[model samples]
Structures are given as structure tokens and as C-alpha cells.
Target: MNASTAWRVPSPAEIPGLSYDALVEHLRLSKVNVGHYQSVVSALQEELAKRSPTNAYRCTKCGHTEYQVGAIRTARSGWSSFFGVETAQYHAIICAHCKYTEFYQGKVPPGQQALDFLFGS
Candidate 1:
């Protein structure tokens, strides 16, 4: 294939759909230049890093390394609930040792947010 039609490095969103063996096979079959190959490798590495479950999350309160991610919670105040306004969403990170909990604002995808608003998640 010509340079213009050559396969490009996949984005972060696309990385999850691609298996390592499939990526290797694609690289082998494609006429990817050295720069493109390097870019693909770098992108794969980044994706792997992002997917790694070995993240070290230390609790600030008790300095515990083990933690759990709680489910996404939707919060609405009395007025907001009454008015049917948008609800604030959050995820709680709980420490295993001291039961320390930290809440972080959750980022719901636009499509999921719309569906949640419609179906009440």
C-alpha cells in the first residue's frame, strides 16, 4: 500500500479493541515506515500503561496501599431533584486499612450521561 493509504497508529480509544497478537500481525503485514512503526509502538506502550492494574494508590490518611473503587454515585440536592436539573456524579476511593474514603467527581461520557438522565441510573 502507498504511504497515503498506510495504516495509522490507533488512538487511545481504539487501543482497547486491539489485541497484542492482532497488532503484531498488522505490523507485520502493513508497509509501515520506521516512524509510523515507532509511533504505533509508543501508542501501544501508553495504552498498556493506562490499562495496567498495578497502580499504587496510597491513602493519605493512613498511608495504606490497598484501596477499592466504589460505584459511580449520582447526587442531587432537594432543589435540583425537585427541578429535575442535572445531578452531580462521583466515585469513592476507599482505603482498605483505615476505611478512609475520598470522593472524586466522576466523568460520565456524553452518551451514557444522556442515557442515565433518561433512564435514571
Candidate 2:
């Protein structure tokens, strides 16, 4: 939490048999703050802005660019270990058009990483 110190995501293998409550407690005590709430709506808006306006969102399968916009969570990205499951620092985008989803590695936040294994959507 200091300017001089760097943040490192703890590998899941390092933490085995950790319970959900314990993980939450550790995060609380460590002052680990995930700054923003990333939702499907937000992700879609972001992707939409980056896409070409004229072309619209093209369907890869049909080659039709016209379609409705939405964000789909394809998966949780990160290295996994016996200790815990780390969530990806950034969101993976799934396209409703043409069912094309893309993961952009460029936008993951610094010092923003997951600490435990999280299953399900």
C-alpha cells in the first residue's frame, strides 16, 4: 500500500486449504482494494467505443456487422495453483454478434490481481 513497495499477486500454490471467510479476512486486513466494479454493461460500452462505428459490430460467422451490443464473460483468467485460484485482473469480452469474444491483455491494472480460487460465474 505504500509508494515504495510493489504489489505481487500471491500464487495459488502458496495457499492451500484456505477458506472463503479466511480469504476475505486477509484481503480486508491487507487493504487490498479492487478499485472498479467491472460489469457486462461497462465492458460492452468499452468494446463498443473501440469498435468502428460505421462497420458496427460485425458478426464473424455471418459477416454481418449489424447487431445488438452486449458483454459476455467467457472465463476467469489467471494462473492457478493448489493453494488458490487467482482471477484475471481484467475482464474477457465475449461478443454477442457472431459469438466472437476477445481477450485484451493490454488493459490489466497494475497491482490489481486476484488472491483466491473462485469458481462459477
- Using lDDT, give the best candidate's number: 1
Worst 10 residues of 1 by lDDT: 21-30
What is the alpha-carbon lDDT of model 2 when measured against the actual structure? 0.38
Q: Which candidate achieves the best TM-score against the true structure?
A: 1
lDDT (10s digit) by residue, model 2, range 15-121: 23333333333344344434321222233333334443333545556666554433322225443434344333333444455556544432222233242333422
Cα misplacement distance, residue 62 of candidate 1 (Å): 0.9
Q: Across residues 1-121, which tens digit of lDDT does each residue of candidate 1 receive?
A: 3365346566556766776544554456434466656546666666556543335688889898998888554545775455444467677888999988888664455676566667665
What TM value does model 2 have? 0.28
Every model's TM-score: 0.46, 0.28
Error of 1 at 72 (Å): 2.6
